[model samples]
Target: MRLIQQLIHQAVPDLNGRTFERRSARGIIVDGTKILLIYTERYNDYSFPGGGVAENEDLIVGLHRELAEETGASRTKVLQEFGYIDEYRPHHKPEYDLIHMESYFYVCEVDCDFENVQPEDYEIANGSYPVWIDIAEAIQHNRKVMANQEPSMGFSIARETIVLELVERELLGKASAV
Candidate 1:
């Protein structure tokens, strides 16, 4: 992990001494009209199954690994990169400087049965379950989760923006057709 961090610093010389900067990656796993979501035990909110990128790993590779680890969805093809979300949280204490992270979004196809899927060990440690819900239903449920339940659901910029980006692209495609 330390080696990867060093590599990242070498690759992106602009980053400061923030080796363990708070980082995350989310996999937008689409299966027909339904998308895969993970119901987290800790937060009791649902989001797409994916997690943080390793120290030196490429974003795409980390995304693939995360998706597979979370949803057992090994066969996935990344379709498009939807923008990114840059946010920060307090480091050790509220008085400290914020730890910044930029989460990249990718739309992808996966072939897995949501019901039978098992989250990998790390996901089990996080207490998450793979679930497939209709896109519209998932969005509405996520809104509720964000508003009333888990804060992560609503606070996840990557999840929110990725969905919006995909919807916007779809709408644009439709408009161009007419």
Candidate 2:
């Protein structure tokens, strides 16, 4: 899959410190004009349904597995490669650590028959749940979250906001016309 986007943050990190790199795979699952999103109460924002790709796991397979784990989608069809984003920032709280992350994205559609998603304890405690919302609404809300500037979700929400707009302008545009 070709890289569609690259994002960089200007925050300078400690010259001599630990650098953490995390690679994640996220999904843009849609049905009609509605899109699936993960809502994190801790940040009071929304995000795409995905997480870190396991070592040695193929991108597509990891995404499929993540969808099943995060949204409990019984089945999913990989529609297209959406894009990719590279994020850079100083680690929250731990100032000496610089966090660099690569997020791979894809468009997908989930078939019905979902079970309870198996989420970690933190997710359950934080009220992180999946919800379907209009692409426009998703874009609006994500932008709001970004605008509010919550430290935890600010950067991530900004990236998701971009994806939402693109999916709305491109994918939803075509789907509506059809």
lDDT of each: 0.59, 0.77
- How accurate locally is residue 8 in candidate 2, as Cα lDDT from 0 to 100? 63
Find the candidate with the highest TM-score and give its number.
2
Cα lDDT of model 1 by residue, 92-164, tens digit = 5545344556677677887655554656686677677887776666555555565564544434533553454
Model 2 residue 6 CA deviation (Å) reads: 2.6
**Model 2 lDDT, residue 41, Cα:** 85
Query: What count of clashes does model 2 give?
Result: 0
Return the lDDT, model 2, position 105. 89
Estimate TM-scores for all models. 0.66, 0.84
Give candidate 2's whole-model lDDT: 0.77
For residues 92-153, could you state the per-residue lDDT of candidate 2 as single tens digits?
Answer: 76643777788898988886334658887878888888888877777777676666776666
Clashes of each: 0, 0
Error of 1 at 133 (Å): 0.2
